[model samples]
Target: MALNDVEEAHVEDREGNRYFVYEHLAQGSPTVTNPTGKETYRHSLAATTVRPDRKGTPYLYTLNLSCRQDLWDDLQPLFKESIDSYRLVPTTSNYIAPDVRPWQFW
Candidate 1:
């Protein structure tokens, strides 16, 4: 889904790993209605980190969450927990050549 009115900030997880936190409205998403019958856009939150492999090839990892704007506050703890628990698993297989773009997964 496309994101609009984006905002970003640099943050660190509990282990001191840096991540980019993105907050935005999810465009083309169905409207969510609150208890009062007020319709609101879906608010999206994403935390991303980049780490290099043993060969120095960069890999991207991301954790995404979404909820109705009205429930954002209530879900903050859950979101933080998920982000804080994010970790990368080291692997010897599936290594991409340094000359290849990381996004070219096939």
Candidate 2:
């Protein structure tokens, strides 16, 4: 998908974990129409972070949210709250055994 009017920033959450955030606008297919008879468009927000797991393997974590462009102003605060609450829980199963191939495990 393509995004327009993109803005990006580096931010930290409440726990001081860093994240890269992107805010942009996305236009849906013109062939599809919403109930309002207008082409659909959305305000999209994405936040991503990379952190190591128990075995020191890094993984990318992302949070994405979208709302109708017209409702973005009203929903922005809620989206921020949700993103601020994001936390990574390190787990033992996050890594693969050195002797095993990824496909073999599945």
Candidate 3:
């Protein structure tokens, strides 16, 4: 998929429920979070919770992302701002970006 349209979501077992988080990969090969794919994986897990199949309940964390190139240039900063913007209600975390080589992934 294109850079501005690269979205990744993952689910992890934590606590006693399922969590979800996401990340948005931008285009122009701009400096973004390294392992953003995995980064999103963890992020998605942190967002929500998952119920356990056994006697113990499990919390889930989801790392979901939005593929938007408009913030590609300033993914880190924008990510932070976006979190703050959304956290206005109760969330306590935001997004962080690192530099990575896209071509190397291939």
On lDDT, the leading prediction is 2
C-alpha lDDT of all candidate models, in order: 0.67, 0.71, 0.37
Candidate 1 lDDT, 1-106, residue by residue in tens: 3346685556766455677777777543443344443344567677888878777877677888887776778986888777667765555687654457756744
| TM-score of candidate 3 against the unseen true structure | 0.26
State the TM-score for model 2.
0.64
Put down candidate 3 lDDT per residue, 14-63, tens digits, no spaces.
43333454454443332366543432321110144343323354423333
Candidate 2 residue pairs in clash (backbone atoms < 3 Å): none
Ranked by TM-score from best down, the candidates are 2, 1, 3
**Candidate 2, residues 56-91: lDDT per residue as tens digits?**
776677888998888999999999888767775544
TM-score of 1: 0.57
Question: Lowest summed-lDDT stretch of 10 residues in model 2?
Answer: 97-106
Worst 10 residues of 3 by lDDT: 38-47
Backbone Cα, N, C clashes tallied per candidate: 0, 0, 44
